[model samples]
Every structure is written in C-alpha cells, then in structure tokens.
Target: MIDIKNLHKSYHMGKNSLHVLKGINFSVSEGEMVSIMGSSGSGKSTLLNILGILDEADEGTYTLDGTLIKNLNEKVAARYRNQFLGFIFQSFNLINYKSALDNVSMPLYYQGVKRNVRTEKAMHYLEKVGLADWASHLPNELSGGQKQRVAIARALASDPKLLLADEPTGALDTKTSYEVMELIQGINDEGKTILIVTHEDDIAHMTKRIVNLKDGLIIDDSKVTQVRAKAENYV
Candidate 1:
C-alpha cells in the first residue's frame, strides 16, 4: 500500500542544515502491520511525517496507495489525508470539551457527512474499540486507555486505507499498553495496514515486522513471528 524510495529530508536552521532522512526505502503491503524502531534523533519521525504527507521531503519518491505524493498544496494534502490516511498520536488528540462520541464523530463532520449518519458511524467504531458505554463521557472522565480507545475509534470512523500511529501506547501503563496493542492487532487481522513509530522494543515486537532506523537510514528490516498482546495475560 506504501512504496517509498531514496527519500531525503532536511531542515534548515539559519545557516546550518540538518539532514533527517537519508535515502530511505521501504514498502508495506495491505494487511501488514509494521513498526519503525529507533532511538532519539533517528529518522523515524521524519519518515512518518513524509508518509502522512504532513511534511514534504527534500528529494526522492513516495507513492502511497499508488498515488505519487509530493509537492501538494495544503488544501490538496488535507483532502488526501482525510480520504486515505488515519492518524493516532501519542497525545490522544481528542477535544477536551467533547464527549467521546462527539470526538469520534468530528472527522466525519469535517468530511461533510450528515449528522445522523456520522453519529451512527462514530458509535459503531466506538463499540468496536470496546468504548460504547463510555461514549457519553468526556476525555477528562476516562482513563488513559479509555482516551486512547476513543482516539482509535476516531481514527477508524473514516475507514481510511492506512493507519499511522505515533507512540500509540506511550502514555499508558504496561498493562494498558498491552491491551491497546491487542486491540491494534485485531484491527490488522481485519486487513487494515498499520505503521507504528515507537522507540519501545516490546512495542515493536507486537507488530508482524520491525524496521530499525539509525542515523537517518534503515539498518534492518525483517519480518518476525508476531507477539500477540493479550490483555488478560498482562493483567
């Protein structure tokens, strides 16, 4: 679903230039779950930003879901992002004042879905993430795991082709992280392509493939027997 080759990215700070991604290359097929692992200052975040079309690369090619991605104006980029990509962030970026159901339905509202249809779809996804009963609660009233579940439901409400999660379990305890990964695994099993950017080794292991990055390049890319995260086992 994603094909990137010779991608290069750099940032200019006054007269100094810092190269973030150096000729990165990778492809992810539909129904595959992959993790990008790296330490601080690695190019994982740069690569992900490029993949999400949040930032443009300095050079090279990125083809997502078969369309070449480059030089998109902000409006076009926003359109593609809404149509094809779903994002989950470390911060669980939910509206603080909105109820869980309203948060989940916000994306659909932006997409111009009718109010009733959007609410129905949002509730369905909230139920999928085991948060149906919590739909009326605000983010402040929910636990970290509950908030993240609502965020995941928000991401899924649009039925995008790819899901990009940046440190999805970063804020939670170990048991909660495991529960979240278990939910993510079930999503992948249903044929959704996912890419997780995480520094945690255990988190990377939960994915079917791990791609190691260092000094702006991919050092290792290999498939492994997936480690299933069972909430019960963690508890």
Candidate 2:
C-alpha cells in the first residue's frame, strides 16, 4: 500500500550539493514484507527516511496508502507519521529511565490516548514480544534483545498499517537477532505491511522480495527465497 515514483533527494554541503537519492521508484503492497539492501551512501537509509516521513525528498511522488505526501508541512507530516507509521530503529531509541511498558505507552500518550486504554494495549503488545514480565524494567536493566523487543512492542502499540525498520537487529547477537526477526515475522504474517532496511544477506533473503540500491538509485529488484546466512556486501 505504498507507491513512489522518480524520487530524488539531495543535501547542501558548503554550497555544493550532495545527492543522497538520485531516483528511487518502488511499490509495496499490504501484508507483504520487503527488505532494502545497499552499501553505505547507497541511498537505502535515505529512501527509508523518505518513506517513513522522517525526511522530505527534493523531487518525487509518494502515495502511502493513497495519501500523497509530496508537499505536506512538518505539522501535517508529524501527525500523519504518528497515525500511520511505526518506526523501529537500530538503536532501539528507548528512554533509558523509563520502564519498558512506559516507553511503549509514551507514544500513545502523546497522541492523547487515555492512560487505561493505552496501557492495556501497550501491555498486550509487550506480551506478544515476550516482554510481559519485564514491563517494569528500565532499558539499563534489560538486555539488548529485551530492549529491542520493547521497541518492537512500542512500534506495534499504535496498530500502524506500515512498520518501517532500519537495521532492527544490528545491535543484537545472532541468536537474539533471529529471535527479534521471528517476532517481526509474526507481525508481518498477521497482515501488517513491513519494510525493513537491513544489510544482512540472510535478512534480505527472509523477505519475499529484495531491493538493491547503489549510488542513490535502485539497481535491482527481485523475488527470492531464504538461503543460508552469509556476509552481506554492506560496503
């Protein structure tokens, strides 16, 4: 339920222009899982930021579930992002001093959800991520996997139509990574659209389709099945 066409993005660096995305065009349907693979400066993350509405592109047309997002102001964009997008970052992005449940509930709270209703929904997602027992624990008290799971729970608390993840398992061990992926996979299986930007080859393979980027352009798109894990060309 996402559509993009001829996307171009650039930045100003000391009066010179640095292109981040030359032109990106892609589509992702509802209930499908997709991954983006690319080297550093290849525009994968930039593209993700654009799709996630964290940043605006210089020129492009993006329709997220039929909402054209070309010229929306920051206020509008922020409101839409909160309502429609769920973001999972590589750094977990959890508040260090807040309990896991509180962190997950914070988003909804900011959105004006009442305490009782949001807390119940937040706890439900935490239970789904196997973090029910650790709801009262702070980030420092939880392991990396636990922290990421908390982040996952937070992302799911909004019941967002789209889940946008950037290197979701990058900070965890292999076993933990697999565990988190399994959690994300479960969400995807339940009819949520998932778009993950990861450099891991196996992670890309686990998705139904992979989009490869190079030099700020989409170079390849293909359907593939899961294979053995190997080092990805993240360069």
Top-TM-score structure, candidate number: 1
For residue 121, model 1's alpha carbon misses the true position, in angstroms, by 0.2
Scored by lDDT, model 2 comes in at 0.89
Q: Show model 2 residue runs off by greater than 4 Å.
A: 227-235
Work out the TM-score per prediction.
0.99, 0.94
lDDT of 1 by residue, 16-125 (tens): 99999999989999999999999989999888999999999998999989999988999999999998999999999999999999999998998999999999999999
Please, what is the whole-model Cα lDDT of each candidate in the order they appear? 0.94, 0.89
Mind sharing the TM-score for model 1?
0.99
lDDT of 2 by residue, 1-235 (tens): 8999999999998989999898788999999899999999899878988898888889989999999987888989888998899999999999998999999998798799999999999999999998899999999999998999999999989888899999998998777787788788878878999999999987787778899999998899998875433323221
Which regions of candidate 1 are displaced past 4 Å? none
